[model samples]
Every structure is written in C-alpha cells, then in structure tokens.
Target: MFGLIGHSTSFEEARAKARSLGFDEFADGDLDMWCSAPPQLVEHVEVTSRTGKVIKGAYIDSVFVPEMLRRFKTAKRKVLKAMELVQRSGIDITALGGFTSIIFEDLNLLREERISAVQLDWQRFTTGNTHTAWVICQQVERNAPKLGIDLARAKVAVVGASGDIGSAVCRWLQRTGVGELLLVARRPQPLVALQESLGEGRILPLEEALPEADVVVWVASLPQSLTIDTDSLKRPCLMIDGGYPKNLDTKAAAAGIHVLKGGIVEFWQDIGWQMMELAEMAVPERQMFACFAEAMLLDFEDIHTNFSWGRNNINLAAMDLIGEASLRHGFKSLGLEPASSSSPALSIA
Candidate 1:
C-alpha cells in the first residue's frame, strides 16, 4: 500500500476541515492546539490503473498549517512526526505532499530519522518531485501549440530555475531545444551553477525576464511586495503557475495571457478519495497534485524506493521514467482551453 502525507493551506481551513472530519477538539482549539495535534490517517483509497492493476493507499493528515512556519521547532516536529507515523504503519511507499514535503526538504529531515527510538526508512518515502516536473513540462509542450506558440521559436523564462523542480524543468526544456531559455532565481550562485550546467541558458533577474518571456514557468513563491504588471507581458504569453497556493491567476489577470495551473494531472477514472477535495482540486474525484500520483505510480509498478529526494538530484532520465509510467497508467496533464473571442481567458480541462 502507498501513503500520502499532506496538510491544509492555512489555519482556518485546517480548523474547518478538522471539524468536518469529526475532529472537534482540533477545530475548537487554537493554533497551539494544532501544534500539539498528532497526524491522522483520515481516508482509505483504492485506485485501478488502465492496465487493471488495483492499489490501496491511505491519506495521513499532518495537522500542519502555514501558520506553524513561524514556530520553526513546531513545524519540524509536525513533519517528522507524520513521517514517523507513516513509517510505523508499514506502508510500502509514501509521498510527502504540500508543505509537508517542503518542510522535509528545507529542514533536511533526513538526519532527524531517529524519532523517539523509531528509525525512519528513507526508502519508503518519496518527495514526488520527478512527476511534478514532468507534468509541468508536459503542460508547456501540449498547451503552447494550441495558443500558436512554438517552443523551438519562443523565449521561455523559468522563475525559481535553480530549485529541484525548477532545475528539472529547465533540463527538459533545454533537451527539447527551446529557442531561448531564461533562468531566474534569488541566489546568484545556484543560478550561475545551473546556467553553467546547461551551457546554454541566460541567467537574468526576474524583472528583466518577465516582459521578454513568451512562456513563464513559475515554481517559486513571489514576495508579498512583488506585483506583476500584466500589461507588459507578451501578446500571447502562457504562464504556468507551478507553486503552492496557486494565486497567479488573480495576480496576472489580463487579456491574451493564459495562466495554467501546473504540476497537476487528471486521471481517466475516479480514484474515490476525499483528500483531493480538501486540497481544493477542480475535479476532486479525478484530479490531484502530480506529486501524490507519483506514489501511486511507484506502488503500481512495484518500484518501492525513494524515487525523488534531496536537492538538485532530479534529472532528465528520472523525469522520462516517471512520465512514461504516468501515460501507461492513464494519467495525463490537466488540460487548459486557450482564450479566444468567444471563450473566457482560461478554462480548466
């Protein structure tokens, strides 16, 4: 069986979800109560692939909210505890989703495996980044043509290009032979290293890259003070928002610009799980974050190991491996209908 470790987007949402799930104590209590709350295995899931292979899984809510980020120790404890619970459950493989994965990677939780005498088996968990990168890249490849943007002749900019998912997307785009690739990130050192590795990308500031991009792949969180000027973007620009809290549509709303939700995939058959509803997926029954699907894929193929982990470890070959499995299992990139005279700016597929 596979497992998914996840969390709510905010404190209020977390409280409301807890209440709905009959966790009245968690709902009635304050943020402090949440910090002390243990992870809960709230749902059981069964998915059948196109090849008729059925896999069973469970969803373990970390009971973590974004507010816990202010308390570093609390945040670390929440993630570690959830991981420990999954390991103790004897799950064949598991995926860390949302902030659970972020906290795991950011805090380097690998070294904190010994939690109260229980050792975390790293092989049983996956960060799920490989499938995410693959889904985002597939969105770019499949949707750009519908808008009349040929990737080989277009200038593409990847915000947060030095991150695990960002770097993997860059490698795939580079291999596909984009006309011009602009690599943007906060740190110069990593950005420089990425550019040197690619041997063919332009490392530029976000301000300079935005206006010139025909396609923008965002995998980083924008600063609270930052505001995008949608008017300055290219006439037929395509922006793929691959980050958390996916609010780019509100930030960059304008005519002739399309913002596609990235890192999302749609399954042909309903998986019959409520976890996606809590995640606010458009089609709760059929759609999910690509990261979660990675665990399902791993379980289906019997490739039980940490498929994706650590920083800068995602490569083109790994992306291809997962991408092929995704298609074979009847998973495809979430579709988007481009805007036209009669259609709205963007419509989900």
Candidate 2:
C-alpha cells in the first residue's frame, strides 16, 4: 500500500477532517491517520497506459503548521508517529508530503528517526519532488506565452535554488533555454556548486535576486513567510509560488503581478471518485500537488526505490521518468486551472 503524509492547510480544514475521521473534536495540533478505501479508477482514468492499476493506500494528517512546525522537536515527533502509522499499516512506500518533507532537510536525521520507530529501509521513503519539478516546468512552458514572456529570452530567477524542487526547476528552465538564470538562497556555496555543474547562471542572496527577475520562482524551503518586500520585483513578473506554507505574500500578486500556484496538477478527466472521497482530504477539482501524485504514479510504475530523497539530487532523467509515468496514468493538466494573469494572490494566512 502507498501512504501520503500531509497536514491540513488551515485549522478549519483540520477540524473538519478530524470530525470525518471520527474524532469528536480535533484541536489545531492534533494528528490523525487513516487508510483510504481502494481507489476505484473510473473508465476514463483506468484506460490509461497502465491498463488498470488500482492503488490501495493510507493518508496521514500531519495537522497545521503553527503547532507542528513551531519547534523542531514537535515536528520531528509528529513525523515519526506518521511514519510509524504507515509502517504499521504495511505501506511499502510512504511519500512525505507538504511541510513534512521540509522539517528535516538532512535525510540522515529522518533516516535515524525511521529506524528508531520502524526499522525500515531508507528506500521506502521519498519526497516526491521530481514530479513536482515536472509540473512546475510544464506550467512555465504552458503559461509563459500567454503572459507575453518568451522563456527563451526571459530572465528567470529561482529562490531556494539549493533545495530539491528549486534546483530541479533550474535544470528544467536551463534545458528550455531561459535567457538569464539567477539562483537565490540563504547561502552562496550550494548556489556556486549548482552553477559550476550547470555552467551558467549567477548566484545572489535573496534580497539581491528579486528586482531583476522576469519570471520569479519562489520555491524556498522556508518554514515561515519569506521576508522579501513584494514591491521590489519588476512589475508584470510571473511568480510561481511553489512553497508549501507559501513564501510569497499575496499582496505582491494583488499589485498586478501574475502568480501561479506551482507544484500542483489538476486532473481534467472524469474520474468517478471525488478527491475528497478518494483521499478523505479537502482539495479542489480533484487537483493534487505534484509531490503527492508522485507516489501514486510510482506505484503505477512499480518503482519502489527511493525515487526522490535528499535535497538538490534530482536529475533530469528522474524528472522525465515521473512526467512520463504521470501521463501514462492519464494525468493531464490540460483543462485544469491555468495560472491566470489576472487572478488574485493565494491566501497563506
């Protein structure tokens, strides 16, 4: 069975989920874990290249961020408990979704924690960032033209460039021929290493990187809101806000900047089961963050290895593999919500 570890995006959502899970009352920090009913794929979803692979799995609610993430100890405990739950439920591979993936940047810490709790092999875990990068790249390619920006000549800046998803995104943009690339992160060392390997791009601190970018990819691993003054970016910028807790202030988008919720793909086919019933979670339009989709697609491919682990190690081959697997599984972003040039900023508050 496959397992997805995630947290509610808001307190209200958390309470609703808890009640549905049979909890009379669930406070902000309470965690809940439950198994999904066998996901019955409809004809449209089942006729994909995978023929008909039905995935049986479980999902964990890591709860909202403020309590779980306020301190490392609390976050670590919650993650360990979730891992234990997945292991006990006999899930072969568990995808660490949303904020849970970011709590421990050093996978070794997570590894030790896993061993302490379940003694399972590290290969049983993955962050699923490869599919996330695939979705982000696809969004950029699909939306750039409409935004009147030529990616071939656009100045693209990737915040949190040293992280897994951000680095993969940089690689994808380079392959697509972005004219200028700027890598932004807290430190310069990792950025330097990435630039040396890619043979291009300039590395700058976060503050210095914003004003010059035509298309800003804010995909940082920050636990809290980023401290950038949104007003600094060049106007008419296309900002792909890919952070889990979301790093960009919506006010920036309110001032006429184009912002697209990144790392998510919406399924347009007539899937017989609603996402809420399938996963027992609240998500709009059967759309899921690419990170979570990675697990489902990998299950279809029977690729049980640690497909995406650690930071900054995702190569183009892995990205391509997940992308293809997604398509074969009948996953398409075609009619899903495209990042609108006139849409309001996302509310992370």
Q: Point out the worst 10-residue segment of candidate 2 by lDDT.
A: 35-44
Candidate 2, 245-322: lDDT as tens digits: 654644364554677777776553433433334333224435677787787787778887779988788999988888
lDDT of 2: 0.67
The reply for model 1, stretches above 4 Å from the true place, is: 338-349
* Candidate 1 lDDT by residue in tens digits, 1-349: 9999999999999999999999999899998888999999999999999999999999999989998987889999999898889988889899999888888888888889698779889999999999999999999998899888999999999999999999999999999989899999999999999999999899899889999999999999866678998878997888999998688887888888888989988887777888889888777778889999999999999999999999989989899999999999989787575222222335322
Best by TM-score: 1
Model 2: how far residue 133 lies from native, Å: 1.2
lDDT of each: 0.90, 0.67
Q: Which predicted model would earn the best lDDT?
A: 1
Error (Å) of candidate 2 at residue 174 is 1.4
